[model samples]
Structure formats: C-alpha cells, structure tokens
Target: MQRIHWFSTLLLGFAAASSAQQAAQPAPAEAAPLSAPVGTDPVVTQPAAAVEAVTNVVDRAADAAEPAAPAEAAEAPGQAPVQAVVPGTPAAATAAVAGSTAPREGKIPALDSRLFPRYDSLQPKVAFWTKVFGQYSENQSAIHSSTYPNKVFEVLDFRADAMRLDKLALARLKNDEETRAKARYNRLLEEVDRLRDSPQQLNEEQRRVWQLYADVPGERRFRDAVGTLRAQRGLKERTALALETSGKYMPAMESIFRSYGLPVQLTRLPLVESSFNVEAYSKVGAAGLWQFMPSSAKIYMRLNEVVDDRRDPWTSTDAAARHLRDDYNALGAWPLALTAYNHGRGGIARGLQKVNGNTLPDLIARYDAKSFGFASQNFYAEFLAASDVEREWKTHFGEQLQRNAPLRYDTVETKHYVPYETLRRLCDADDEVFRKLNPAYRPEVIEGKLYVPPGHVIRIPAGHASAFNVGYAKLGSSERFDSQRSFFLLHKVAKGESLGKIAKQYGTSVASIKSASGLKNDSVRIGQLLKVPPREERRPGPVIVAVGESKPSLTRAETAAVEAERREQARPAARSKPKAPRTHKVRSGQTLSSIAKQYKVSVNSLRDANGIDGSHLAVGQKLRIPAS
Candidate 1:
C-alpha cells in the first residue's frame, strides 16, 4: 500500500497520532556529532526517492495535547525508518511530488484572515508551525523550546545522509539522536554560561539562541528554554500530501460546512485533524475524519460493535459540522471554538472563566488548566498553519503536488439487513473499494458474519448504483435478514471456565480474547467479566517529542461529555441508600421508555438519575439505575 500521508495530517494539534509516519524515523547514528558552537544543523534534505513520506503515524486529534510529562509518546509500530528533514535549508531541488515543474500561476485560496488573524503575540508560534508544515520534511526534527515553540535552537537531520533505513539502522539512528540531543542540551546550557557575562563574545549559534529569546529580558529565560527544549518532526511531506488528498473530499466538506452556514474554509481542518486520514484511529479510541472519541461520537454518529460512523467520511463530516457549529455557538469565538474541538469545550469554558477572557490569545497565553497542555495551546496555530499550507501548497511543493480528483459516489439506503458480500457482488464492487467508501462498517459486517443494518446508508461506486438497486430489489426473505447475527458482547466466567473454553464458545481465538480486555493470563474466576477482542493494527512506533510546552495526550477525553450529566449522576440519593442499584447493558431495539417502564420508573427520572441526556443507546452500553 502507498501508505497515504494525508490521513495522518488532517488530525490537527495531535502531533499526528492519527495515520502519520514516524517522525522521519531518525537514522541518527549515521551522522557525526555536532562540533563546537553547535545549536543546529541546516543541511539540505527532503529527497523524495529517499523519504518514506507516507508511512502511517497516528493523529490524536480528538486526543487533546495533554501536558507533556518528562517522557514523550512513541510512534505507531511496523514502519521502516526514514531520515528526519533538517531545517534552515531547502530539500534536494527535485519536486516534492510528481507534478509539473512549473508553479501553478493562480490566486491562492484566500482564508478570511479576520476570522483567524495572526496575533502579534502568536505570530512566532504560527511561523514556527509554517516551517513545520511547509519548510521541514518528515525526516527533519527542529529542536526548540516547548514553552517558546518558535525558539527553534537545533535542526536534527536523522537522515544522516541516508534515504531509507532497516530496523537495525533505525535503532542505531534513534540511539545516536538521543545521545546527540542530550549532549547538545547540556552544551547549550554550558555555552550560554560561557557567554553569560561576555555579551560581546558570542558564536553564530550562541548569538542565535540569545536572539531567539530577545522577547524576554536577561539570559534566564534562555536557560529555561534550553531546559524545555524538545524536537518536533516537520509535517511538510505529510501536509503537502494531505493537501493533494484533500481534493478527494474537500468539495463535499466545504459544501457541508456551507450548508451549516459556516465558513467554507473551515473544511480545511482535516489537514490538522488526521492530516485528513479518514481511517486514522488513535491509541485512544478516537476515530474517523473528525477524530471523535467513542464516548463523544456515540452521540452524533452510530458507534458500536457493528458500525463506527467516525470512520465514514460522509457521516463523520456531517457530525463534525454539527459539532463545530455547536462549539462555535458555545464559545462565541472561532479561535476558542476550534481549540475547544480538541480541548474539551468544558475545559475551554473553564479556562475562560478562570482568565475571565474569551479570546484565543487569552486562552493560549493564560489558560493553565491541567489538561490545557501543548495541543490545546497550539491548536489554533496549527489550524492556521495547516490552512495556510493547504491554501498555498503549490508555493511549498510546486509541481510535486498532484491532487486527486473529487470523490464521486452515489449513496443508497439498505432496505434490510443485507449481507455485505451479497450487495458487494451485486454492485460488482471490489471488496477493498467497498470497504474504503463504507469505512464505518465494523469488521464483522465486512466479513459477512453480520449484515448491514436496516436503513443504513451505503455509498455506491460511481457506476454501480443501478446494479446495487437491482440486486437489492430482488432480495428475498432468506437473502435479507432483519437482525444482526448474534454477537458475544460480554462473557461471564463460570466455575472452571477458562479462556480456551470461552474462546471456543465465541468462535474466537484465546489470544484475541486476551487482547481485547488486556488480559495477562488465562486464570478465570467465577463472575469474571470479559468481552471479545479488538484488533491491534497500530503498535507504538519510534518515539518523537513534538511541539507544545504541555504534553500531547495519548488518551481520548469526553470533550463532549457534558459536566451537567456528571453532576446529575454524582448527586447522591437524598436518603442514605441501603443497597447499590443494579446496572443494565442496553440492547438493540430497546429505549429508555421501555427500560424505565420495565424498571417501573419514569423516563424523566431515569434521565435525572443517570447522566444520560438522549434517548439513544448502543448495545453493551451500561446504564446505572437509581436506588428507590
């Protein structure tokens, strides 16, 4: 597979935990260590023939940038390493992509700067990101301050003059990068000390560090910056690729936003979200073009064992539009609203209340909540940078940018629970093609074990609509099912029930059963609980410390998880409860009214008792009952 890069970059503010490549998996040990007065290396890099630009990395778009702890998050696994791009110099003059050598002569897509005006205070951050998104390539690492992201002090080119690398080579390179970075960190502090009193005695690199923090008085902030130094892999390759990829889905997205009376340019967000990787799923359970966490996505899109609309571009786009509109309405500011898309609206609202300010700059400069870490701070800057890169990608890559044509497909509704293979063959659709267009279908549905849910919308290949309609029209009672196949959603252990026996009962492998629930061993006890396993497609790859003073969260949050529900749920019973209430997992075809009636309680009481605000329920979703 030509591992696409766009899917990774569209995940905004997430250091692309979504389907992005390893930070040009640094071939570190290949290069010689820096000599005296060393702050950065600006060697020429970014050779297309050498760079694995499209290797899939993860974009934790929905996973807000958590406060970075001392340790950094690792990349998804199974990717062959490539050199990181070095900054301060252009890449080899070969076009970034295979396109016309001549730059496209046309007016660039003009974003409404008023809506996202680059604040003077935030311009440095935006410029730094421009370099990350357009100037630097995947193989390049800009060692800069976490607090002062624009104060880039070093450019570590892990390429070590190599284009590609094996695992051994990658390990060596990573080791070399760590050694050099650690050495340089101390050397920077030492150099600043040597030049502390000798303001007049400064080398090119030393002078560069001093000038980077010219905004702050004295050299204390310089030392502080060195202490906070981190390396962020550039996304030039990824964002450029995403710009090309955006063509396939941008038209529909822009139309969707416009339908919601939003700025059409907001459609460029996927460049920041998962680099527009519609299939990008985080280590946390955030998924889809919108990168909705399962807890949050369940409210807008169908997310369950059978379907995850977050993975479906069409459905996810509509959901994102609605979500963004709602965010904007609540925050009353585009910058804060966009930031809230990643940082929870509740968190942002709390930040606003704390600062008593509502501006993006205010939040960026002042918000100090535990969760308002790197991603939250730089989210607006990233959005602006991505938007800029996407708008004028030709300026950055010239003829290398060859965009895909807009996706053309007609959608049809399934009349019944149709077998995936039956409809697939009827429409003459290739299985892979079918899968991409209907990404929301869970593996069971795609494998034909489970049928397409009734009334579900399926996108048809450009020319296969008529064939699908004909096939669907002829579906007999035996051909079209009205219900999903039985799913072993949960299993309770009986005495002497082992994982082997449980796997057999579910027709699944024991390893998978263990993987789904993170089970360590096969020991089973009476009343033990377990669920079927989820496939682990992406393992943590090479570790790269990306931007933001705060940490990038690898976990998904309930951003849409309203606090009202939590408070309501937390309200203790007026009377000291005698016993805890029993819980129930919602099953298909069941509603609150039915459940409440069965429990002999009012629907309103059920809503007040638990945090549930909507009538919707997913199978296996547990709800706590109130004690009478």
Candidate 2:
C-alpha cells in the first residue's frame, strides 16, 4: 500500500509526469526540477544518504538473484544458488542481468533535492506569505491567545520592481541604521492599527455596497483583508515566538525525524500546526503541537480517561514522524504528503486522479474538489512560510529575542497505581512542577480522584533519578494510596436479607463481601452495613428464591394476571392509609435509607417527593415526605 515515489518515476517516467500535467493547469511558477543533484546543503545531503543506502541494498539484491530451473532436472543435495559477487561491479549491470533472468525490481528512487527547493522565487514566496498571513489572521479574529504578538511591523523590500527580502539573512546595519529602523517600525505599527480601525466607521455608500455581498456564505470580504494586513504587520513578532519555541523541541524532534529516515525540515511543521504550543486545542478536538485528532491519535498514541499521550510532546513527535513517513511512502511527494497531513491521503489521491496531475504544484493550482477548502489548499504554503520564518528568525529579530531552553526530563516506569500526593512527595516536586512534567495525567487524576495508572512512564525532572528510585523503593508496593482500586459501595442489610441473597443480588461472591467487610462468618443482622462489589461483575448463578420454592416459569397471560392482582392489592392498601406530614427534618449522618425506614416507605418514593436523586443528605434540611 505504501508505494515509493521513485518506482512510479523509474517505470512510468514522462508518462506519469505528463499525465499529472494534463489533469491540472500548470502552476503559476515554474515547476521545481524532478531530479536535481544533491548539492552541499546538509539538509539535502542528509536525506540523500538514506536514499542511497536503500538503493545499494536494492542493487545487491538484484546482483544476488538467480534463475529457478526445472525442479526435476536441477535436483541436487543441499546445493545453494550461485551468489553474485564482483569487485567494483556497477549496479546497472547487476540490474540488467537480473532483469533478463528474473522479474525487474528495485528500490523506488528517493525524493530528489529538486522537489524541496528553498523558495528563493518571488511568485512562490508571495504565495507562502499570503497563506501564512491568512491563517494567522483567521486565528487572531477568533477568541484565543496567539503566539504572535498583535503589535509588530513587517518590513518588505521592493527593489528591482519585485518584492523580495532574505528573511533568513540578517541585515547588516550601522548603529544609526538600527535606530532608524526601530523608529520606522513603530510608525508602521501605528499606521496599520489606524487603518484597521477606520473601516469600522464605514460611509453610507460603502456600507450599502458591502451589505449587498454580506449574505454570501463563507465570505467576510473586507474584514478578511484587514485581518491579512494585521497578520503581515505582526509577522516578525509571531516568527520570533515560533523560533523561540522551536529551540526547546527542535533538537529532539529532528532526531526523531532522522530516525525514521525523513527530512529534518519536517520538524518545523508544528509551527504551522500549533505554533509549537503543547496545550493547543482545535475546535474539532485535535490537540497538542501536532494537532492530532482523537481518532488518528488512538491508532498511534495511548488516549483514555487515565492518560492522553497526545499532550506529551516527546511521545507525540515519534508518532507524528512515523505517520509522515507512511504518508510520504504512499504519495511519493513531500507536497502531496504534507497536504495529506491537513486534509487526508484518500482525498488527496482522489483529487490527483480527478485532475490527472502528478505534480504537487499542478495539483495545488488545478485541483478543485469541493472538499479541498481554503485550509487544505494552503496548508503546504503555510508550512513553507513557517519554515522560512523559523529559519530566518535570527536574521529578523537579531539578539533581542531569547531562545527557550531545551526541555530535559528523566523517565520512570511506575510499578503500581500511585496517588498524586505520594508521587509528588517521592519526586520532591510541587504541584505546578509535577503537573508540568506530567501533562498526560488528566485533571481528576492529579486531583486524586483517580490514581496514576500502573506502568505509566512518568517524566521526572532531570538529575533526580536517584532520588526518585530511592523514594519509590521506600514507598514499597502498597494499595493504600489507591482508595477506589476495587470500587466498593456500602450496602445496608435489610431485616429478611441474608449474606448469600445479597451476594447473588449484587453479583459478587459471598467471600468477597466477607473479606471486604472483615466478617468472621455468614451472620448478618438488620441495619448492619457491609461493603459490596460493583453489580456488573456479579456472578451468574441460581438466586435464593424462598424457603422451599423453586423458580417459576410463567406464560404471558399468567404474568399479566399476577401483575394485575399485585397492583389491585397495593391500590387498596394505599387508599386505606392517611397522608403523612408534608415535610420531614433531616438528622446527622441519617441517609435516605434511615428516613425511609422511619416512615415505612421506599427510598425512591421519598426521593421523588423531595426532588432529589442522590443518597447524600445534610442535617437540619427540610424534605417533602410523601404519604404511604
């Protein structure tokens, strides 16, 4: 299912490329080269090594191949096929012989440096910035905090009749020039803010004309333009924040990417996905830096009431890298593969088929599927913008901004369900520090309602490994920290109830109840309290019927007759009794059970009259007692 891009290229060649071009219109800019040589760039060279390594393996496999002879004619005892080994043998010769002797097969070629060009082109740069501005503006217009500061100015150079700026290159400036630049930046920010607010006080002519197009769906024409302008103005601020955040996680994330034999630049993707915010949550329930939805996350990460690994940056990075690797193997192009991150693989594949476009640039311009909305259409562009920003932050912000410190932690696998207080004491960390180190634990778990799940790899602060180990050993293996491990509920014994009958009703063994309650024998008295296990785990067995009665089987007619007789008998008894007082006062530790007993009524009847559902009661509270 995961087809490499090179296989399509090696076999299909021009046909595949041409078919893709025919499906969609040519992109606005010239297409990147399909097979550019890996130059000196480390980023380019790093991936090339992995691709070349795979190619070497494929070549060796071909050279070692031998043709199968007729089974009866070629019979020999324990004879091995001839192993091909030649000093300085060319891969092509080995492949040619293998092709003649057997079916043709080779490793699909790796993504050439041609597809991932550093966008120095004007057309693509503008497009990338436009998308970046669009997404930033959209988020700003919403009711959430943005990583990019709202007040900042973006400086663009318009020389040679073209818009250009080496955002990643530091501007060589004299002391006086730095002073002038700061002054100019302040002025631009003020002007942008003034222009943004001026549109709100629209003239009559403009207001009427704008209203004409107001009813259109998904169109916020004027407001969107203003938001884009604001985004452009604040680009430097947001880019700086992204760069700072990247400092903390990029090293580890890049290591993970390299481990999967993926491009290291993929690590910058979180800037577009969540601005590197570990706590970022989307409207559609996607969470964390990668913005993974619950459905996709469950496939790769552990997600449940106890722990949500999606919030764990370290773990989620590994999952995200693996997912991207699979996508690349399937689509064979970084552009389409990246698009699949925002949209979906199946959708992108269908869009390509519909347009017959093999190239990502072509698909970008021509693919017009309704499902491929603005976000999907511009995802790759946004990623490019974020990458550019991340790479060039030092050039723009200079030494004024500080990089965030890298995160350091030690992992400890808890042996048993540990309570928050116990773990906190063991780690010698305050609540804030503990929670910061362990974001995967839900709020209830941290608040002590639930225990930290057993075998969970907890992240403790670095340099405290020995202390944690000692504390854990000292704590030993104990269930006292877990109060609800078995989840028992209190059961009050009734006058006619026996231990065996109670056990059968509650679906628990009599021995379980005896152990939980520390009972010496099966003896139980009226009003005696006992601990009972949950009902869902109850054993399926014959219930205690009556003194000498066996379970009865009744026909529909007979059942109906018995129900009618019972209702008739109850109706006369209810009519015979007088109504009780309207309200009854509560007493200390006296629950609905005791109150019901005092009035000779069912707890359900008492609750319905008092308009309460739970068993909890307070002293001196008035309740409406219904007549029996």
Candidate 3:
C-alpha cells in the first residue's frame, strides 16, 4: 500500500511539471516583484524565462544587502553605485542600515543631533544680539536695517570690524532691493566721512559731558563724530529675548557673584561682553561671557591644554568676581574699575597720571593718551546703557519676551582621569547634557584627545550620583579612561613648522598642543617629534591662523633669510654724494608751520615745494623742505 501511494505522488509531480512547461510565457515589465528573497520555499508554475527573471531580481536585492559604500566615497562627486554580492543573512541586512550613517566627510562635520536641543542654552540668546543692534541704532554709521525706515541705521564700534549689520540688515540685503540697500550703505559711509570733516555745534550740557574732547588734537572732527550718535529708544525684539534668556543664568551668575562678595549688579557685565554668549570669542583673544583675555584669565581661571575655564559660565563668573574685586581694590571706584576692565589697569593708571585727576569724568575729559581710543572712552557709558535697558526691560519690551528656566545640575569629582564619553555614560545623560554642564573642558577632551584630569570635578544632571557610582563600578579595574591609553598620533616636525600650524592641522590649538607636548614657547624646530592630539574630525584645508598673526612655519634657512632681509630694511638708504632736499608730506591736522617746526626748516621752504603761495596745505600733498 505504501509503494502504491509513493508512485501516485510521483506521477502527480510529473503532471504538474508538464502543465508548467505548457503554460510558459515571456516575462513582462509590470510583472516584476516588489522585493526578492533568496532561497525558494514554494514552487510556482512559470516559463523558464520567468524563472531566470525572478532569479536575477533576487540576485540584485542580495547584492544591495551588502554594506553601503562609505559615506564619503558614495557621496563623492560623479560617483556611481556599486553592486556587490554577499551571502543571504540577517547580519548583512543589519550592517547595511548601520553603514548608511557613517560620519560625513567635510571640513565641518554635522554636529551631533543631540546637541541641537542644548543650543539655546549655549548660544547667545536672540535678545542679546538684538540688544547689540539697538545699542548701535540711530547713528550715522548704519549699514542697513529692515525694521527701520529706508532700512538703514547707524552702528558704533571701537573695533572697526565690530560694526557689522545686524540680522534685520542681513534679511533686507537678501531682498530684491539689494541694489538700493548697497547704495544706502555707501551713502551712510559717505555721511560718516562727511561728518568727520564737518564742524559740530554742541550744547552746554553736551560740552560738559564730552569735556574729554577739550584737549584732543582733532577736537572738531571728534565732536562731529560724537554728535551724530543717537541713543535708541525702546527695546528691540531680540533685546527682549535676550532679557528673557538671561533670566536663566541670572540666578546662577548672581549667586556666584554674591558668594564672592561681589555686587550682584556685576552679573550684568556679560550683557555687554557677549549678551551672555557662552561661545563668544574676540579677534584679540578675549572669550566667553566675561570676555576675559588669555593673559588675564590665566590669573583667575584654569586655561590650558585640557581646559579653558573662561567658556564655563560658572567658573568664569567666579573668575570675573575675583578680577572685579581686584580692580575695585586698586581703583577705589566702580567707574574706574569698569574702565580698567576694558582699558587695562596700566592704561587707566597712565591716564590718571597724565590728567592729574582721580575722578572718572575728570580723567576722561583731561586725559589725552593715544591708547585711550573710542572703545576705552565709551566702555563705562555702554555699560550704563546696558544696565538701564536691563532695569527698564518691561517698559521697553512688555510681556512678549519668554525666559528660559534656571539651570540645575550637580557635580562629581573624578577618582581618576576619566573620558568624557565614559563619564557621560556613567551619568546616564546625553552628550549635549554632559557638555552643557561642563563647558570648561577643552575641545581636545570633548574630541577624545585627553581625559578629564585626575581630581577634576565635572557637572552632571541633578540626582544622578547613585547611578553614576553604579555605572562606574561596573567597569573593569583596568579601564582607565585616558587618551594616552587610547590611540593617538605622533607627528615629527619637518623643516619649518609652528605650534599654530600644527594645532590647526590636528584641529587643536597652540595652547592645547603646548599642554600636550609640554612646549614652553611658540617656537619649534625641525626633526622634533610632538604628540598630536586625536580629533574626531579634522578640517580639510590650509591652516587658519588668526588675522594679524598669519606667520607660517619657517625653516632654519628661511629664518636666516628673513633676518637678513630685516637687517637690509633696517639699514639706512644709501645717500647721494650731495644730499637732495628732504620732502615732507602734509598730513591731516598738520599746518605748514607745524611741518616747518618738525623738520627744523622754514615755512617759506615748504611753501616753495609746489609754489604754495597760501597758508593752506592739502593733506597728502608732497612738499620740498630743507634738511634739519
């Protein structure tokens, strides 16, 4: 009976095969399957050509299942897709999804998405930049503005480059009236130049307030420049936002300041420095909310390869407290102390001596030092303006502004050097949370160049101490989260190289390189091997040295050549057998009489240079004069 049943099944299979062969037909485009899985489980009745088509589809899908090409190679310009074959397995599918997210190749990689949420806390509040814009409004120096009539407004900056157009101007520039905007910009510059040359009339009150101009060389020019400046009324939208955002930090900053016996009002200093911008950096090397220069920060903060305390709001506020206290002690007045904060103690001291005055108003009016430029002169006034705005924000901005909640965090001291990643994981917080709490750590530490130094305290989310300890203990005894224990590259100095160049190359800084390599000075030599800090992503381009310090690495031979060239330049020009009459160039604010006195030559000789019969001497006009 079993043999009869098996024979009956075999005959049924043969009958089905014959039926499939008889129904064989060409495969059509519309008949293609949406997906193909390798390894047939069920047999279907189809033509031989259709079976081959199905096999080809399955082969292509299996090839696609291979891990995607590296993100950089796949995204390369004019790149073509590559088909590869791999064994049909779950692991291959898992890898294909994972490979799609490879780190992008670019000068600046996309910041971790987790960082986006924390940006508001780290970045300058919109209100802060708005306040900056308002401070410069109603002046003759505006570049352009969308909110104002004719889309133009004035800005004032001691540093020429700081007088940039605000967001409103930027938006207006992107409009169809860009040509008109440019014309208005040029007109503003011309107006400022014209005002600088034109004489200005000042009221009695204005003259008293601007008494510092009495002894200035170009009093008329300076007076006109000052007269054109107008204070803005009411708070701008961004300034209002700044006030609201600053509320979050006010509690912490005020607490820190009060702890150090500082006036709570001092907490508002960041309003002028950066509008409480944690990442604010200046061309002159000032940084953070407090705007501390490297030299000054070194006194009250830990500024080194592993950390820059200036960027940490809490740490920097403490440092600022110490500095402000020291300045008050030396100057015996808040006005002088504040001025010294901007102008340096030495500069303020020199100004006091030159003017023979102790009061800020008197010194400001009488002191005529060259270094007492516009920025130093107006630092206190700007502070006063910022303070007033903070005090009267409600009247100016109403209730439209929104404030951030106060920051809350707890601190933990590391028993040993710990990696940021390890500590972040131990605290069970995201990267942004970890970074926002500890902004003092240098990029090297964040990028994995170094570890949290031994005995250093790092901030973590509130109420995570127990979890932190548990996670830390779970790790092996030998897991000493140190950079040296991890992979790092050692670079050998070749020919001419500089700390700046090497730092840029490795996406670090001169200070970081110095701290890592234990360098004592800016100088480096050929064949000297230095440890290059590890970076998660290195910018691909030429080294970007700060402006005014673009000196490249120089070899021994090049240094010698530079020295020889300097010597040649320093050497006096070869004199003719008979010395020709020296010439004097008439400069602004200079008279013929002044030129004659300077060169110890007669005014008649200067007049005879180009037959100048009148006392007038145009600026830049070359005049022949007798040798001293």
- Model 1 steric clash total: 46
- Tell me the tens digit of each residue's lDDT in model 1 across 1-628: 0112222322232332221222212223322211112112211112233222122222233335421111223233221111121111112111111121111212334456677666666665776677788888666666666676765556666554345777577657655774577467657666876687786888765665555555566657656655566667778877766665555555456555655788866777777777766666666656666677755564455565667678877667766776777778777878877888887777788888999886888877787776676667887888777766655555677754665544445455555567888877776767777776667777887877677755455565555566677777777887785344434467889888889998876546686566555577887789988866322222221111111101111211111122344665799858754686778788989998788878876554455445444567889888767554
lDDT of 2 at 157: 26
Clashes of 2: 5
What TM-score, over all chains together, does every model reach?
0.64, 0.46, 0.48
Taking every candidate in turn, the Cα RMSD to the unseen true structure, in Å, is 17.3, 24.0, 34.4
Compared with the true structure, what per-residue lDDT tens digits does model 3 show for residues 1-628? 0011112222322233343332222222232111112322111111121100011011122111111111121110110111111112234222322222111110111212221111222111222223443443222122222211111232222222225756466434333233443454344434444544432654332332233223224534333432232222222433444455454455456545555566666676676666666776765667787877776765565666677888877667766776777777777777777778877776677678878888677765688665664456555555544654554444455544444444445455555556778888887887776777777887778887677654455566655666676776676655553213333457888777888888876666665455456677788899888766444321111111111111212223223445666788799999769877677677899987788889876554444344444578789988777555
Model 2, span 1-628: residue lDDT tens: 1111222222222232343333223232322211112121111111111110011011122222111111122111111111111111123223322322111121111223355543222233323353343333211211100111111222222222112324223222222233454444344334433443465765543433233223323433333323222112223345455555554555456555655677767877787676666776765667787877765665555565556777867667776876676667778888778878777766777778988888666676678665675556556656665554443434445545544434444445555567877877776777766776677777767777667644355555555557777777777546323212344568999989999999976656686677667687899999999977433211011111111111212222233445665677687554456555777889888888778888777565565455453568889999777676
Clash tally, candidates in order: 46, 5, 6
* Range of the 10 consecutive residues with the lowest summed lDDT in candidate 2: 49-58
Ranking of all candidate structures by their TM-score, best first = 1, 3, 2
Output the better candidate (2/3) by lDDT. Answer: 2
TM-score of 2: 0.46
Worst 10 residues of 1 by lDDT: 541-550
Off by over 4 Å in 2: 1-122, 125-235, 476-628
Give candidate 3 regions above 4 Å deviation. 1-238, 481-628
Local lDDT at 53 for model 3 = 8
